[model samples]
Target: MPEPLDAALTKVRELLLDPNLTRAVAAGRRRGQRPSVVRAELRPVVLKAGRRLQISTSDGSRPYTRNVAPGTEAGAAVDALLAEPFGNWHVETADATLQLRVTKSGEAQLHRAAADRAGAEPSGHDRTKDYLLDPGDPIFAEIGGSAAKRRQVDAFLRALAATLPDELSGPLRVVDLGCGNAYLTFAAYRYLAQRGVDVELVGVDVREDQRRRNTELAERLGWADRVSFVAGTIADAVVEPAPDLVLALHACDTATDEALARAVRWRSRWVLAAPCCHHDIAAQLRTRPAPPPYDLLTRQGILRERFADVLTDALRAGLLRLHGYRTEVVEFVDSRHTPRNLLIRARRTDGTATGQQRAEYRDLVDQWQVRPRLARLLTEDAPGG
Candidate 1:
């Protein structure tokens, strides 16, 4: 049922000022016009002297933040957010979660549910701030991601949190394809386990040493029963009871193709991949002349390399859409954290390739005169392949 907008806003302000407030998030533009910040969030933080509410805003590419004292200051901040044309608002306290949505007709629809507990305090990029991944996890001492790696893991897990289903029928089986060092592998397991999720995870790496080291770490952490590592290639790794989610982070060059191909073949429900290099497509671009007048695009070594990265990922996304998956290419983290920051997040859907889609893909490949490894791996029997 819809609630009075003023009433909802009042309740939200109260929650924001409450000392128990865990988090408050506002997303999407309600007015259908782009806002200065794509997303904004507020959470309670404990300072050395006292408690305060921290507000963080992200403009899709970067984040800016500020801290306000509780009571009037926090309420004013909350009012400023409510005044914005954000489509959705969610607030959580120690006891309950409240959600508000603005309808097309300007009605306020609200929902409430019990919350389990206080949210985890993630390790913040700034020494004084909090982030999405807790910095003090025991695994960090062994796996080591507290510094530079923290941003990558936090960004990846934030996507996973949003992608995971609201409810689960049984244990979630996850496979990390080409999980070299397995930093993310351990982080995922620990995060889900802490949430009381019945999750079983497997990390596959071609190197036997990595597998052994990860296995030893898992055993030492008392997670060997639920988390395991395998010494095998992403293309040939045998994960019993095919995974519900597949993660391929930083698989270099065409190795990423191999991982995506394997995930599509398995019909995994979800896939999150962060490609490391576009060497295959870049090398092909160097060998062939750019299509017609666009020759200027590839005339320079640096420009050609950057263009190949864009073209390669675009083609990869188009291919995934043709393969019955809803695909989105997103920057999971800031480029400063890692140059290879593009993450391909896909969810299995009933989408079918239309004649127009197929034609466009074919036309693109013909114009470029370059065969992407992903296309060749996925559509070997197709005409171009």
Candidate 2:
């Protein structure tokens, strides 16, 4: 498979074709929930309005697309949203919200708009000048983002930064397990710092070669002051000033479990793990009796692989709850881009784990007839009360 694009172009014509990006911007901002917005050059899409179809700018003047569902509240929301003057419309569904921004673009044209705004004093650029394209800045190109998409990612990262604790903030200590090439660690450090968040980061991997190259890159980024690397197996190494946030991106199977073990032992406030390769649990699942209605799912290899993912994350979530952490298993990004799509963001809950939590976990494992790699590892040698 081709290397996944860390970001995508902001050209409206090109982006409209990517189903995942469309869904994300739409789902992100809708009525009655956090809003999702997108910025793009104008491209009017025509929609059938009963007997006649009208093609118009997303002026909100034309009614919502026919795909929009019906209901009193939905109708009211749509009407209210349309009254606003926007080249793009914000659509809010029951579970998703997206924004569409449409504008015309060109370099000289943008500068003209910015100059126009500056003349007004205490002013910002005219709407036409707000765009993702800025030939002057190359970071946008290197990072795979248009200025527009970078804004979206920035918003998401800032939100994530807020959700994690302060310990993960000030001189924010971080450890990235399996930090091959260290691109993400680089992104995180830059993202946080740009937002005035101070961070000290460490990238861990078994490959001495990768560590050497990454350390060189760190120095070049001027992060040599706060960032460094330790060469060895993640399990074998230990970090001083225990990290406030621990990330193990695509750590294979039991390796993911090991990453989690390290975070939990340190009792780190935040744990982010995008687990990859369910080969271990899939092996155990081979012999298990299928739960009643799920028996049919196991018959299909594709479905079985899918089931392994859900079952594994579910068990992992339950186990986290049992160990006093609040967890969310959410779409880290679109599945179309990566098979390892689910991100487990766990925050430590101060209270002790309740007996009910333990009982529920046991019940879930019994029903799945499979044990999670993390559960098996952590439960062993757990202190007897």
Measured against the true structure, the TM-scores of the candidates, in listed sequence, are 0.66, 0.60
Candidate lDDT scores, in order, read 0.78, 0.55
Off by over 4 Å in 2: 1-159, 165-170, 381-385
> Which digits, one per residue and each the tens of the lDDT, describe model 1 over residues 203-262?
999999999998876654456667899988887777887888999998998998988888
Local distance difference test, candidate 1: 0.78
> Which sections of candidate 1 miss by over 4 Å?
1-129, 380-385
Q: How far is candidate 1 from the true structure (C-alpha RMSD, Å)?
A: 17.4
lDDT of 2 at 80: 38
Pick the TM-score winner.
Answer: 1
